[model samples]
Target: MMLYLAQTTGEPTGGLAGWAIDVIDALGGLGIALLTVLDSVLFGALPIDVLLPLIGYTASQGAINIGVAIVCAAAGVVVGSLVQYTLGARLGRDRARALLVKLPGIKPESVDRAEAWFARHSTKAVLFGRMLPVVRPLISIPAGVERMALPKFVVLTAIGSLIWNGMLLGSGYLLGENWHQVVDIMGYVPYALLGALAVGVPLFLRRRNRRRKNAATAIVETNTSG
Candidate 1:
């Protein structure tokens, strides 16, 4: 669900976002952190990106401190992401894939691509993948499945979360009353990502199949020679 802030009052006065604002006001930075945790662990559980900028807008109005907001949000994201990673680790690949593929918007193919991406990129996928929208949460699954070092996973997740949070918060602070403009721009991202996936997934599958066939052929030839 999306939260809209009232431009005149600089407060989220209605809807889910407004409810979150009420909580943030009552609990301070910790509230923001908790919400961010929800954002990461549960798909579509909260509109955290939108909420972050609104928090930034609040900071700009002197209602909250920007630095504190950034720290709390980033910390929350890391913690939430860890939960997802642990799920993957504990579930292992086959079980994890079976469960994940059943989630409302999660596609079986997306899981396949995430695993493949991690196979190719290893550590860098954990580091950089945290910044991408579709990949951010999903990437953690692959990391956990591959048994990435806990220390390394935390460090990379923290770094990426900080960068992602800082950018949104900074943009909200700068935009001030006009922060919703960012929301407008973000709305189109899903469509763009869909187009990319539609094209990319097929190509990825073809390459993967070709590689497997080649490996199989090599094995057959080696056995014949023996």
Candidate 2:
């Protein structure tokens, strides 16, 4: 789940992928989680999309427990996502979008689109965006801007991230050494993931709309009681 952008940084550990592997090998589950945290927070990209399969391959060699690795990764993503969401909430949409534009590797169009999408879909964006790349992080921003209920935001992020992370980890576990190093995690997703999304999106939207209504009812009740 953890990876420094090997493509750019030339391995944070040392001279070769060998050293990189050594670091990952030595750290195991904790390493995976930590790496994922950074990646989810925009620190790196190699972790989930590229290194996950490697982690699985190593696990197949009995280097780490696949189950533990998966859990750690999923948890890491959730933690990191919450951080991003909190940041967005604190910054507000305009400030956040402005900051994002100044940051490297983030597209302005992506930010604009995500904010617009959130305006329409609100929580549904949070629920499903975790599985998306640019939208995944930026949607959290708008959710923060709109002041989404924290518990609901985290829960939805966890669910979406779990599905996304689980697929990547499982694919890595299955593909092992044969897995390709995907430079773009969102753009280069596995076919299995695409298939899952095709089926899951509609169902997610349906459930999300229902949840939205229920949440409205809860808010009214809370206000009435107070």
What Cα-based lDDT does every candidate model obtain?
A: 0.80, 0.70
User: Model 2, which residues run further than 4 Å from truth?
Assistant: 1-23, 43-47, 181-226
Candidate 1's C-alpha runs over 4 A off are: 1-15, 184-226
Tens digit of per-residue lDDT, candidate 2, span 76-141: 877887777888889987789889888787879988988887887677777767666657656777
Clashes of each: 0, 0
Query: What does the lDDT read for residue 154 in candidate 2?
Result: 81
lDDT, candidate 1, 142-187, per-residue tens: 8898889999999998897788788788888999888767677655
